[model samples]
Target: MYSIVDIETTGNGIKGNRITEISIFKTNGYEVIDEFTSLVNPECEIPYFITGLTGIDNDMVRNAPKLDEIAHKILEITADTIFVAHSVNFDYNVIKNEFQQIGLDFVRKKLCTVRLSRKLIPGYNSYSLGKLCSAIGIPLKDRHRARGDAHATMLLFHKLLRTPNADKVFKSFLNAKSQEATLPPSLPKAEFEKLPTTPGVYYFKDSKGKIIYVGKAINIKKRVLSHFYDKSTKEVTLCSETSYLDYEETGSELIALLQESAEIKRHYPKFNRAQKRQVQQYAIFSYEDRNGILHLAFNKLKMAPNPLHIFYSITECRLFLESLCETFELCPKYCHLQENVESCSHYKIKQCIGICSDLSYTKEYNERVVTAIESLEETKTDYVIKTKGRTIDEEAFVLTRRNIYVGYGFVSKETSLTHLDDFENYLIRQQSTLEAQRILESFIRKKEPKILKFTAETTR
Candidate 1:
């Protein structure tokens, strides 16, 4: 059973808006069993522009009964039926909000004709109620009015039921539980339920399909639900604007992090504040002094030419340099930790080998610095990091050449990734950035994936 519904609102269906008119048709996929239509007195003035579009002005509904008067009829007609509409969210949410104001919980399983048409009909240029009805030879009268649109949607639903294999699809939709208990009011419960509990990046989109936030998680479903569970003002605002969710599964958490960082840089989503800025703000560089001794130093990124490692913050750069100094007995003064001192505090404490005082030969001290620099640098060779794919039988890999990220892709177990041509054919090349380099290097240091080295001979 389905209740085909339509609503005409005074403004965008947010908090301030009100439904001025509504229509509902009770159907069992073939014919209407009952019907209800009403003009709602919103208790607020309708804007002139909305009146022009919907043909419902304040004067027309001034004496009409308010939503509370007809709320019972609306519920009775839609009872035990899946809510159906052209854009189900708009119609469903408008009515739901009205019922909430009257101290009633309006929850119903929903089916969107727009989604169904996209799947069942296919090849339509537009799915708007008017355009779709016209293309499919359904005569639509009194366009923009609630009853007219609801009737048209009902006809479209009937036609969709006739599509081959649509009964099985409809049965699946009917059996699925409503996700309203856990999801935000604006997002579709069906869409939220479809999210995978896999490692990947997810995007939250507004009603217009514009991405508002990008996030990565080991479990995409759990991480996304966390946002809704949060009570912070920003999280509430994000949920309010979000109407849809989209995701990409990365088999490895390292790839997921890299992709999330790249997407945040590229999209600069309104909700993602930290990662929107350039990540490579600081870097560590090695230089030769007048005495021909190698010294490691940290500086702002633009000042460094070909840095050995990149970092997002000066503090992280300093911390890494301090660790390297402790590990290799390098002079703190050379690493910019102690400025304008003949000998650093490390030497006084016997932690340094007196490189700052020239007590250690420049040749010997420089050798340790060279080793530290090499340790921080990524392998300057072409290779791939192989990992699990989206499925068990498939394999995923990230390709890099000369310490630059090429891209990532997947292949079945039967296929061999042995040559340059294989990589070119399978890989989806991404722009190599400093952030990508840092993510790849950090992951390699921690996880150490099985690296497949490539060369010219292998390509042939």
Candidate 2:
């Protein structure tokens, strides 16, 4: 049995958003047995953009039943059905969160048509409901509406069922348990059971309480259990040697990533290969030549007096150096890629502006080097990354000063940090790793967190 479901919500599929409409079609693989659809009064003002896309505005749901009023019907209809949706996680999580608010546990085995289609159908440019339906010549009406999309998903699911290997794929998916039935041999089931289904960092420890691996996940419980399901040699060994598990809830995924990198470096976890290495082995450095041109070069990290950028491996360092050479028209010989040659290959091919042959003036070549240096120096700014805390009234922050990750700490919302000294007071300083710095830098580039100039700040 399957419950094909769709929902229209008031905001992006995150916490605090409320559902404005829902539709569920109960099916037995070949035919629809029952159905339920409703306009739900979310009891909040729907955003204008959401109204534009979904066409379910505040006025449409003003007199409709609220979610709690119809929650019981939802529960009864969905009972004993495998929850099915185009993107299962978004709909499933929204419905699950709504149920939790009403003191109910809505756990269901879930199947995503998107995943199934990609596996069973294959070769489609997109798996989105409208696109996939159009490609297969399935008529999709009322595009964003719950009942419309749910009905379309039902048809799509029927098509997937008729594929050649559908039975084999469906059986495999069903046999895969939603939750782990067994834990690592040495681990206590109680400890694993207590793992939170929240964004955070988790540590796999040995019998001696030594951390063997550190990982971060949006859902800690699921990710930890996946480790046990792995059949790889390293994972098999990790599962057998693991005796205990510990975790910290980092309310944001960015923070979780940063924390995981820092923890891996601090513990030098035996199972973590990438982050266990010393901070950085190679770097890009700047030097002035006899012509007074600032030359960009790559060398062993230990030999660089003041490197502009740090890289974990020589290969990564060389790849970045090659990019800089292309970007700034620098000679390959100047970057140490070729030795005992009067002119670089790039110079002969007209790619280099003749920095090696002195055809390019020092001032012009130096300007390009400065541009490349500035581009790679992404962490030169001093700022704090503020994000949600474990609790509602508290907030978390990761501080960086002049390219160094100072530390991360939590503070009360009612209190404000008035100065750098106050911000430092709450910090639990740890040695910064190259991975941590890179994670923080990448997150800032992508998310663009709001910046506040803080001359005087206070936190409680």
Off by over 4 Å in 2: 1-199, 217-242, 268-281, 289-293, 312-338, 341-382, 400-407, 418-425, 428-460
Candidate 2, residues 237-340, lDDT tens digits: the string is 68767778999998888789988888887788999987777755787898987868776777787898798877778899988888788877777877776778
Give the per-residue lDDT digits (tens) of candidate 1, residues 1-460: 8899998888854555688999999998888899999899999999999989988998999998998999889889988989988767566766777788889999998877876776677777667789889898998998999999999989999999999989877776566553343355456666688899999999999878999999999999999999876645477568767879999999779779888988998898999986676655788898887878777888888899887876768888888889988888888888778888887885433467777887457888888888888777545567888888888888888998656688988888899767866877788788667678778888889988888887768755
User: The CA-based lDDT of model 2 is what?
Assistant: 0.81
> Which portions of model 1 show Cα errors greater than 4 Å?
10-17, 27-34, 43-64, 80-82, 161-169, 176-197, 202-215, 220-249, 267-274, 279-300, 306-460
Alpha-carbon RMSD to native, per candidate = 8.7, 19.1
| Best-performing candidate as measured by lDDT | 1
